[model samples]
Target: MIIGIDLGTTNSLVSVWRDGQVELIPNALGDMLTPSVVGLDADGAVLVGLAARERLITHPQLTAAVFKRYMGSDRKTLLGSQAFRPEELSALVLKSLKADAERYLGEPVEEAVITVPAYFSDAQRKATKIAGQLAGLKVERLVNEPTAAALAYGLHQSEPESRFLVFDLGGGTFDISILELFEGVMEVRASAGDNFLGGEDFSEALIDGFIAAVGKQHGLTDKTADPAVYQNLRKQAEQAKRALTGAPTATMTVLHAGEPLSWTLSDGDFLKLCEPLLKRLREPIEKALRDSRLKAIDLDQVVLAGGATRKPLVRKLVAKLFGRMPAMNLNPDEVVARGAAVMAGLKARDVALSEVVMTDVCPYSLGIEVSEQLGPGRFQPGFYLPIIERNSVVPISREQIVSTIVDNQPALHVSIFQGESRLVKDNIFLGELILPVPPRPAGQISVAVRFTYDVNGLLEAEMTVAETGEKHRLLIEDNPGVLSPEQIEERLAALAKLKIHPRELLPNATLLARADRLYQQLLGEQRQWLAQETARFQAVLESQDEALILPARTELKQFLDEIEGDGWL
Candidate 1:
């Protein structure tokens, strides 16, 4: 049976189409929404959901939460002396959800339709798929969160034609999707969002404010340096954030140094602290509206989704921005999961979803990096040449031709990037490939590069040499953060070995090692230099352009040698 999974940042849910409607599957605790937290018990047994969430306060060092923010990055979170990638943590959540579905359905389910933020990049989308695979489920489709919400709403709408905006504010990410419904089709007009912004930021804002207001008085400088204290503060702030949804004021307190540091935050004070986050929210909304070529008045309704939208302040912001109270007929937290279940039903050819047709748009522009001719013999690199613009309907193929920049160039190297940036350096480097071309005078040889994007967010590039009649296809593999098929198998084996059964083995010392431990310890100039160099090196590695990465790696290695070799240490 095929099921729907909303593998969210703060919580996750599973649902399925049953008896002509979507039915949510409850976990072992009889809760539909499971906290997306994972950890290991003192006895080396794995714990997830509410059990793991509660441990965040008592055993902060053994638990990990909010790993979804690093979905497509190489960053690792340490959980009980073992380091895990974001996807690995996500897989544990998905695995638990899958078990819930199986127990509720009384059958084995192997296929799923997972929902992701519409603005999730290709790498992030791929990571979601990998997570599903790790959980023993074949991800049949990946529907965008907003698009899924629209699908669920579209199926129940009485009107045949209507346009609406989906305002999704979750725990660790935010997305704005504009969609239109006509006849029997639901179309996504545009999508925009900040991957790093969400309800967690508000909690963090409060934490920062509390520290600034009372840290020095209690001799609690850099409270976050203590994981237990930080976790306590975070939990308090989260509870306060939730309480403020219905109340005008909430008290936030954390126990530190055997004393209670308490602060009563009024709605006005909370708003003042989160003013920057609120302002940041507007940019994505404006961009989505502009990209759709529609004004706020053009929207028939603004639908809210995600748990964070339940906040009164956020709701007020939405109402103010659209000049209308947003619709919340469907529970904000459950709507996306319902929509994903509808997609699953559609995949299964269920009669309930037979009349609906959904279409999504590419959230970001996909293109290649090129060198622009500056003079007779000079050419400047790092310019982005777009092949497919953002918001274009997906399952699209777009091509653009370009000539060699230099005379007698043996081969043309094509670097693929994804973003709206005019400069390639500022964009996300997807992958690169070198196409062999006959050496000729500048602009004498041309190659047509065609980029094909599908509904799954998989991008394939085909470059054809005009003169040689040769074609090379780049499948965008071997990325540093994206695990390959072989790597996936290896990961699967490793996970099986660490299956969280009763064990007495000692923790591996190296599992707790961090690449930036020294950098975090350094002060001032040296710390700044390390950060800058590390970022520069990481960018080069992400580009996957060996020509640039090799030299940058060498330079960074030398710098690290100086820092680690006796100069600063």
Candidate 2:
């Protein structure tokens, strides 16, 4: 069966369409939301989700989080002695989600429709598909995150024809999409975003503010950087961010040289610290509206999505810009996954959704590099010729023809790129191809370069030499960021060998790891109380009696909830 996945920067979730409704699958911890974290145990066993997220604080060196930001790059993060690519880390999370879907559905799941940020480049989208492959899943489609959000909101509303804007600000990326729904058709008018801006930047701003205020007084300079301390502060910053969503104040504390340093942050202080990030949100919103050829006042509804939009500051900024209070009827965090489930249903040809049609737009321009001839023997290189412009409808094919710049050019060099820059140097190089042509005079041999972009965000370029009718294709499969078949096989075997923490033991393991993490952060009485309760829970697990273990686990969870402020960890 095909399932839907939201492989987010901070969290991931699995859902499926069943019994005429979208059903979210719970992880081993029995929670719909799973932290996108991975780590290794003392015995070298693999740990995922909540347990690994907790371990991030206690064992900072052995855990990895926020790797999604490096999805299309060749960056590697190390856990203990092992170094892993971003795709590898993401695969572990996907594998865990696949297992959860299997358990919930009582069947093996082999295919999925995964959602990604609308602004993700072609390389990043390819990496996401590769991650699904590494997890033994056939990625049927890669749905844009904002498009998915719009789809969910579109179906949820009763209006037959309406225009809406989806403002999606997640943990590590931001996207804005303008859409229109009419006669069972949901059409994306435009998409714009900043892949680098998100809620994480806000947390980082708070961290920087704290360091500037008093960190130097404690001899904590750039030379004295500590991973554990950074992780602790990041956690506190995230909590403070969430607390300030509704409350006017929150406390952020961290340890330095075995001493606790504290700061009480107010809403005004946070706004001042994060003013730059708030300003960044405006550019994309205005761009999306402009590209759609519609003004903010023309929109029927403004929808708020992604977990970051829950912040009061972000909501206020959106409302003031759009002149309307954004729609929040659906859960922001789960809306994308719900839309993905709907897409999966559409793929399955569900009768209830047979009439529902959806469309998406390419968020960036795809083109090829060319040289302009200023005069004879005075040609200038590095000019970019766009084949498909940004915001163009997907599942489209566009072509452009060019001739060799120099006489007797044995082969035509094709360098495919993606961007809106006027110079090839400023654009992103996707891949290249070389097609042989007979030796001929300049501007005599013409080659047609065709770029076909599908709904899955895959780009295929085919170049045909007019003189000899020779054709060459570039599928971007040979990119350095993508792994080869041999490498995938090797990595698959290695992942199979690692002992994943058993599903049956995840509850106890997660609880113990959380308690251990909290223990490291607390002091005096609170630490002692946590230790006593953790010991009790451990004893119950060791007893192996279902009757006592169930109740004991529940009680310990309640205790932790009261102390830790409801899953903020």
Candidate 3:
């Protein structure tokens, strides 16, 4: 069966349209949300979800998180002795989710509707699709995050005729979309966002404050940076952020270079620290409104989405700007996965959700690079001529005419890019093709460049000569990651060979990793007690006494839980 998945930056979730409603599938942890972290165990087995996430704090240099921010780039995350691309890590997450879905549904899941940020480039979207493929799932649609959230909000649940805005600030990406709904039609009028911004930035703000405190107390120098300290700070900062979501204040503490640093940040103080990042949010909001040709007052409703929206300051910013409180009934974290499930239902033509029609637009301009000839033989090759401007309806095609610059020009290099800049250098280069042309005067031999962008954000460019009917096309096809198909297959093989611990051992492994990690942070009596308890548990485990293992495991867990303290947050 086909399911819907939210391969999010911070956490990933899977859901399905069950009994005419969306049902979120929980993982082995019995949690609907799975942390988007990947790492290696002591045995070199791949660890995902909660186990991997806890590993991140204990083994900072050996784990990867927030890799979503580099989806389309050639950047790699080094973990263990191996290096992994963002898409590769994403595939591992997808594989884990697929396994969970299969176990929960009691059947094989071969297809899904995956969601991406509205502002994600073609390369990023392609990488998402490829990741799904690597997980052995057919990804037929790449839904925009904001659009998916709107669906989950069940906009059709409201008045048929309305204009609304979606503010989606997730872990690693931000997106603002303006949409209109009329008669059973939901149309996305404009979409904009900053991929580099999100909840992680807020955590970073807290991190900076705590780091500064530690720096002053310890005089810590770089090049001798402590991974454990950074990792612990990241966890503490994340917890402090959640605590301050609605509370007036929250406390964050960490140890660096034997110095214990702490900060009790008030909401006002936290907001002040995050001023710059919060300010960046307005640009996309204003841009989306401008692109939609609507005012904040024109919106019938303002919607808040993504885990970051849980932040009180973020909500306050929205109210201050729109002059109206945004919708908050739907759980921000679960909304996108639910909406994706609804889309899957729609794709399946489920009778319950068949009435509403959805439409989306391209998020960026599409065009080709051409040289504009200046008089006296000087020409500039970096000129960008757009064939399709951003926000144009999808499954749409547009053509731009180009003339040969010189007499008898042998070929026309059809270089395609996606961006809003007038200079080609500033745009993202998608691909290019060189097509031969007959010898003729520069202006006499012209060809039409056709750009087609589909609903899924798939793009194809073709160059055609009217007279000879000769054509050349550039198709990145569905592969947009830094790796080609051959490379992808090779990587897939490598991933398939990696060992992953049995599901039953995950809980034990995670707890052991956590305890072992804490061992590195403790001292004196606490350290000695933990060491003795860990050794006892290890002896029990190694003894292979099935009768005693269960109780010993519980005993060990209780011991750790008793000492977890406030730092457990």
Candidate 4:
């Protein structure tokens, strides 16, 4: 009745426990991995997986892919008459997998255990759960993708005790996790990552290189002016990138804007293109190791997962960095799904494997925004007490005890954040809680702000006033409207209404090129200013402030104009 699913960014896989073994369910195409893409038919129907991906080359505007990166955010995609949230888009893929399972078993599949990235935020995790619900699945548990991979690997090896590192590099995200095995427990010590960085960057790098090669071969300037041409070239570049991993050189030939374009890239040249991205990956790996206080050599085995890890250069770099070769004996693409099945077996009590208890640590710190006494008659706002330190094991709970600063303050506002920054403005405000206290003297009202992080990384905060015995809970379920099912639907509707015909609906090529240039020109301080201004713009947009909109728009327009005048755009 229950299946294990690895809902990955580029591809998805499904597996189930059967006859004391884990078996992966292949789709109708007889492939273990399904591309996480969706296509809209002329009849307003949805097609998922490989069939949808095949349509991307010609019908790019009608297809949506790589949407997993926007799971927690407000981003949506419009496909013909339908608008889809990241979750809704993802449900199409999940639903397709569900149908495949049903077809194979000749029974309805209604329940599942889905795996998510280890560094996914609370909102992202909740969004994934919502996707499952939308697909008519009773999600028994949301397991961390790395932890699931560890479970599968541990079960496969039948090892007694070992500490292993899971390095996951998918299409649009990367996560490095350190997990330890003690007795029958597989505990995660630490996790770190850049959610925006992954194989997509490598693909971009390859595209850029191909652009240069095409320009040189044809003596044409501004090859990027044609979106269709660029898209075709990008596809060729991706193929070449993959081929160069095993071959000494790879050739790409494509017709761009009615012109014949051809190029050959060597493995050394391909590695050079991705060198910067490979360097960026080291930060997360080093951070994870440092947070766990374990050396790279201390790890018993380093396991690689995700399709991107198939790159020979990535493996070589990882080996050189760790002074050891990674364990690649297991299939990289299927390991996570296999692990999910093992976890399903353990949870169902269907297997005799030792009780594999997993305790994962929080990737980010939790704190509250409060006023700090700076000097005489002066107060500055900053992050106050930290409720959960990074790398603290879960399903753990902690609370910060604080009091009101003003006398007879009937209510106190608690602003929660998740980041290591000392400044309140630098961190993300997860949400807020308002607590009522009994009328009392200054600093007399004792309020406990409790934070609990479960195994899935979902955060729950509760405020309890001791004197009045008043309690308030801030569960994701409680904030229905702000984070509502209907709101998600509305967002999807809005996105659907908006036209995304890349050739006709998007901004002019010149304007888009200018925006990209301006984005790149932003320096250290200017980058921060841009972020603040964008946040302000988003707030104004959310508030629907008609009077403030024009002024804010003008400010942003002027900023863009200045950057253009400075020859940046």
Q: Spell out the clash pairs found in candidate 3.
A: none
Lowest lDDT block of 10, candidate 2: 216-225
TM-score, cand. 3 vs. native: 0.95
Candidate 2 wrong stretches, greater than 4 Å: none
TM-score of 2: 0.98
Q: Which ten residues in a row have the lowest lDDT in candidate 4?
A: 501-510
Query: What tens-digit string does per-residue lDDT give for candidate 4 at 331-411?
Result: 988999998888778767785654667666788887788877777746676655689988898888998888887778888
Q: Which stretches of candidate 1 lie over 4 Å from their true place?
A: 500-569
How far is 429's C-alpha from truth in model 1 (Å)?
Answer: 0.6
Better of 3 and 4 by TM-score: 3
Q: Which candidate wins on lDDT? A: 2
lDDT string for model 1 (32-67, tens) is 888898888767667777667756766778888998
Clashes of 1: 0
**lDDT value for candidate 2?**
0.90
TM-scores, each model vs. reference: 0.87, 0.98, 0.95, 0.82
Tens-place lDDT per residue, model 3, 476-504, is: 55334467888879988998898877776
Candidate 2 vs 3: which has more TM-score: 2
Residue 103's C-alpha lDDT in candidate 4?
A: 79
Best-to-worst ranking by TM-score = 2, 3, 1, 4
